[model samples]
Target: MARNRKSVARLLIKAPVYLVAAWLLGFGFFVLTLPKAIPDGMTPKSDGIIVLTGGAGRLEAGLKLLEAKVADRMLISGVNPVVEPHELSALTGAEEALFTCCVDLDRAAPNTAGNATESNLWTQTHGYQTLVLVTADYHMPRSLILFRRAMPNATIFAYPVKGEWPMLYLANEYNKYVFTLIGEAFKPAPGDAGKQAKSATGTL
Candidate 1:
């Protein structure tokens, strides 16, 4: 009886390690599957930078890239209609005329999926060949899934904005990726996300 109890205790002690190892292995595989991160200082040659709203630093990152001439245009998706161009200009520290000339504020996208929808429309209309997508790092995985579905032929580049509390952000993103993967099973294939929030720009 004592021997059996000791065996059970050992198994219990090892079980956690086994589970952790499995999780790490799974995470590694997921990370490996992702496209390699864009190298630092190599300015992206894209038609425009698509900035998905919501994250703290994403807008700033997009603005910085635009200021640096990484792209000629900028699309700030999921913008509040109530917020005028001047307001956004003040917020982004860019001139209102510059925003009007180079920026597009889209209110159609209220979530990540909506962002994808609006983004696809904007990109398609503008005849953009390459798109530099800016979003929070944790949100990038899900963004890729939705964007791929939305614009399969477009050369989409991810410009992941670093976030505070990266560890927590990563944990949240991993869980979101899992949820999105599972959700994909029920969703229709790419280019058919009409009413659903399946677009890349949709909420996380």
Candidate 2:
């Protein structure tokens, strides 16, 4: 009986230790896989570009793509509501005409999920099917997951803004990415989403 009890205790200790080891391994893989730079000699062009705010160099990265005609139009999501077009132009050192024509602003998105939601609406409004998604490298995984959930039918490309980020910041982002992965994994496909919404509305 004592031997059996010892085996059970060993199993219990091993299980939690194994779980921690697996989690650390997964986290390390996530960090290592993050893009360090856009590969050399590779140029990605899309019909549209969407920049998620609250990241270093993300806006500038997307704006450069837009200016280079990488995409015909660009959406700068999560802009401060009070910031005017001309002011943004001055801030980015972009020509006013560019904002007037090719650039669009979304002042409502309060977070990454909101950025995806707003980008989807802008996409449908503009009829842009292919998009270049720009955000910080550490943020790319979660952003891609949310973007795919939000715009499943659209063709999306990732353009990670490379930079050396703090380890704590990276860890936080990785945890969010893991949770997002779990939360979004079972979400119904795009077609099912539409039907679910319609059914709810009908019940109402």
Candidate with top lDDT is 2
Candidate 1 lowest-lDDT run of ten:
31-40
Candidate 1 lDDT, 44-146, residue by residue in tens: 6789889998878888888878878889999999988888888877887877787878888888887787888889999999998799999876688899788
Model 2 gets an lDDT of: 0.88
| Candidate 2 similarity to native, TM-score | 0.85
Q: List the residue pairs that clash in candidate 2.
A: none
TM-scores for all predictions: 0.72, 0.85
lDDT of every predicted structure (CA atoms)? 0.82, 0.88
Over 4 Å off, model 1: 1-40, 166-170, 185-204
- N/CA/C clash count, model 2: 0
Q: Looking at model 1, how many pairs of residues clash?
A: 9
